[model samples]
Target chain A: MPNPTAAILIIGDEILTGRTREGNAHYLAGELVKVGIDLRQIRVISDDHATIVAAVRELSASHDQLFTSGGIGPTHDDITADAVAEAFDARLDVRDDARAILAAHYAARGVDFTPARLRMARIPEGATLIDNPVSGAPGFSIGNCHVMAGVPNIFQAMVTGLLPRLTGGQPLMSRDWMVMVPEASIADQLRALAETHPEVSFGSYPFVQEGHYGTNLVARSTDAAALEAGFAALQTAFPEGK
Target chain B: MPNPTAAILIIGDEILTGRTREGNAHYLAGELVKVGIDLRQIRVISDDHATIVAAVRELSASHDQLFTSGGIGPTHDDITADAVAEAFDARLDVRDDARAILAAHYAARGVDFTPARLRMARIPEGATLIDNPVSGAPGFSIGNCHVMAGVPNIFQAMVTGLLPRLTGGQPLMSRDWMVMVPEASIADQLRALAETHPEVSFGSYPFVQEGHYGTNLVARSTDAAALEAGFAALQTAFPEGK
Candidate 1:
């Protein structure tokens, strides 16, 4: 069976404005790779309502699964839940369970659960909560999209809690050869190797280090035997790279 | 006048597979903000022809400018130029000028100008070349799209060389206050400030550092005077943030 495809929608104006560097997408990308989920695309867009709704609808409809980060907060700019609800044509309001979580956490700290604080408890209809261990508030999974907080540590924590529930395929196996030569010098060998190994996907990355040009040739496949054969062929073709 | 809006499309399988971490999007996002161009969106997709073509058409039509990186190389997987050409309805082949540049560079190094090496010389019709100083091959600008290399240094160089040719707008001015309080405590003030100053965009980012949670209140505006006024209001509203 083919690996399940996934897409990530990053909703934030701060990232688009260059105020904060994006970390969640990269983090998710690495995590998904471990579980053999194919991350086909990643989109970083602003927190506009129409944009968020459109992005959620498009990504969710196209991919097997979707993940989103940012815009779920206690501030005025936090509008992801409303936008996502509108996309799926679901009603959104503060749920009793979510509100209860916030109330208990805040009551222990002696902080009043203001309207702004209650905003975090608002969730869409027909969604299962993804637990946030660091904070009491929970993220959620509605349809194929999982919406989580923008805070890095919290986002990472949420993903850790969410990945185990997902269906994963076989982890890909790969081999690499680092050759200290201009890519042009080895283009013929790389092309031949790529053509010979139809099961493996090949990549050639060139870099300049210490005034010498080099190419890192990588081959990846799900089949271990094919990857081993490809590696042996690589060693025969470029012994210097070994 | 409003700033020119732009989008970046990154084409690569390595990034999607988590073999490579993306840096070009973040670098270009910061650079675009410096030149007063509003970066509206960023999309990272794999080396699929249909995907690249669709993304190019969509992003090019929606924004004032579009920038692409990766898939311009001397390997079989290097299909971005052809996909972009197809998207714009232009002919793609090895152009004489691009070929000459590669030929001369190779002649200086005394390396064979093999078919694979010649692959780098392909250019779309009606496109102007963007110089790659690090390597001899040139990237191209066809219509609103600027296609460049994916390598970090080369991508940075191409952007630096290309930025001066485009029109620029007023640089954005921004101010921020770091308050040792949960975002919930300042949500009301943030909402009021957002409503009062429609010209400025306000954002509240929460972080937990050293076991204490805090909020970073940021305000941005193109008008320096408006930003200064917003900073004053922020100081008055959250004196503890000082």
Candidate 2:
């Protein structure tokens, strides 16, 4: 069976404007890969309603799971919840459950539940909440779309809580071999080796350090035997101390 | 007139698998912002031919300019040039000019131009070469789509050579202000302030540090006067040390 596929939609003006470098997508990609989910695509888009809604709908329909990070805050610019609701054609309002969670958390700290803060309680109808351990503001999951915070800490916490609940396939295994040779010198042989093992995927990453050119060849596969065989082939092709 | 719009397509399996963190998008985003180009979206996809071709065609048609990084190396996994050609319905073959460039560069280093290395000379028909100062392999531009190397140093060099030739708008100016208050407490005021300045764009980034909550508000505009005016309004709304 094919591994479950996922797509990530990162929404924020700070990322688009280059004011903030995104860390959530990279974090999620690693986690998803470990869980045997194929992360097919990741898109970073501006904080706009139409764009967010379109991306959410398209990604959710195509991929087995969709994760979105950013724009779910109490600021005036936060519009992710509303856009998601519009995408699913669901009603959006401040639910008592979400409000209660926020209210109690804020009350414990002796903070007022200001109207602006209440905006965080607004969720789409028929959605379940994703707990935020770092902050009180909860994320939500409507159908296949799981919405999470933009902040690295909070996003990590939410993902930790969410991943185990989803079904996963056999985890992919990867092995790497580094050789002090330029990629072009070995391209034909590498291509022939890859063709010999159809089940495994091969990738060659070139680097230049200290006036020396080298390539890091990585072999990946869900089957451990295939991965090992591919790695052995790669090692034999470019033995160390050559 | 609005700023010229562009989209980026990052092609690599390592990126999707989280084996490598991409740096080219962030670098390109910052450069595009400074030159007044609106980077509308960035999509990271794997090295699969069909996927790369679809993304290349879609992004190239929609945006005024399309920048693709990765999959243009000499390895078996590198297939970006062929995918790009398929996207534009153009033929792919090794041209004499590209081969000459590679041959000269390799000869200077006293390296043999193997058949595998010659693969780097393949260029889509009717494409102009984008120089790679860091490496001998050249990137190309077919239509508005500029295909470049995935390596950070080579990509940066190509972008430096490319951006100066493209049309640019007025450089964007921005100012940032930080306040030691939760975003919820200032959302309404911020909304009002943003409404007052139609020419400027406001963004609120929240943070929690040292048991204190705060927000960093950023104002951006192509017009320097409008940006300054927006900054003043933000300062008046959230006075410092208050």
Candidate 3:
């Protein structure tokens, strides 16, 4: 069977405004590949309700799993929970389960759970909580969409806990060969090799060093034999490659 | 008039595979903000033909301008040119202008202008070339979509030359303040402040350093006076913030 496919939707004005560099999507992409989930696409959008709702609906329906980061905080700009609810057409409020988790955590620290703080507990009607080890507030998985925090540390922690619960396919394996040659010189052969090996994916990344062009040729596949065969064929075609 | 809105579409398989981290989008986002272009959305999709065609059409039509990076090289994986052509319903061929640039560059270097090398000359009809200072292969702009190379150096070089030609609004300005307070404590006040100043965009980025939660409050606006007034209100509301 094919690997489970996923997409990441990021909601934040800070990212769109370039105040903060987006690392969550990159982090998730790396982690997803390790877990054998193919990250099909990533969408970074601003904190607009209509845009968020539309993206959530579109990505969730298209991919097997849709993971979203940002806008789950206590601030007014954190409207992802409501937007997600609207996307799935689910009732949203301060659900009792989420509220219980936040209440105890804050009470233990001698902090009052203000109305604004309680906004973090506002979850969709039907959703499973994804544990956040770093923060008291929890992320939720409603249908195929998993909503997580924007903070990198918190987002990573949530993903660590959430990934294991979902079913994954065999991890993709890859082999790389570098050669000091322009990509055009080998493009014809590379194309033929790629067409012959449908099970493997061929990638050619070009770089220039000391006025010489080099291509990092990579072959990736979930099937072990196919990966080995494809790599062998690639090596044969470019004997000078190493 | 509002700032010209733009979207970025990244076409690559390496990004989705986690083999490469996407930095072009971040770099361009920062540059666009300085030039007064509001970057609305960013989409990173695979090098699949159908997906590329769809995204090119969607992003190009939705925003005032669409910038695409990657898949313009000579390798088999490089099919962005064809996909873009299909999206715009333009006939793609080895245009003489682009061919002359590549032919002269290669001839000077004693490199053969093979069929594969000539693939770099293929341009969608009616497109103007975006100069590539680092490489001879040129990016093109057609139907409000500017196609650029995926290489970081090439992409940035293309953007530098392309931005000046497009119309821009007033440059956006921002003010940031860090406060050692939970966002919840300031959320209510922030919401009120934001409602009072629709001209400025209020962003609250939360962090947990040590055991204390802190928030970085940012106010951004194209209007200088609006930005100043909004920031002043924010300071008045959170007197302890600094």
Q: What is the TM-score of chain B alone in each candidate?
A: 0.95, 0.96, 0.95
Give TM per candidate: 0.96, 0.98, 0.96
Clashing pairs in 3: none
Q: Higher-lDDT candidate among 1 and 3? A: 3
Check candidate 2 and list the clashing pairs: none
Model 3 chain B weakest lDDT span, ten residues long: B233-242
lDDT of each: 0.91, 0.91, 0.93
Model 3 chain A worst lDDT window (10 residues): A127-136
Residue-level lDDT for A29 in candidate 1: 88
Cα lDDT tens digits for candidate 1, B187-214? 9999999999888889999999999999
What TM-score does structure 1 among the candidates reach?
0.96
Model 1, range A87-193, lDDT digits (tens) per residue?
99999999999999999988988889999989999999999898888877889999989999999999999999999988988777778889998877777887789
- Model 2 accuracy (lDDT, Cα): 0.91
Ordered from best to worst DockQ, the candidate numbers read 2, 3, 1
> Candidate 3 on B80-145: residue-level lDDT in tens?
999999999999999999999998988888888899988989999999999997878999999899
**Per-model i-RMS:** 1.4, 1.1, 1.3
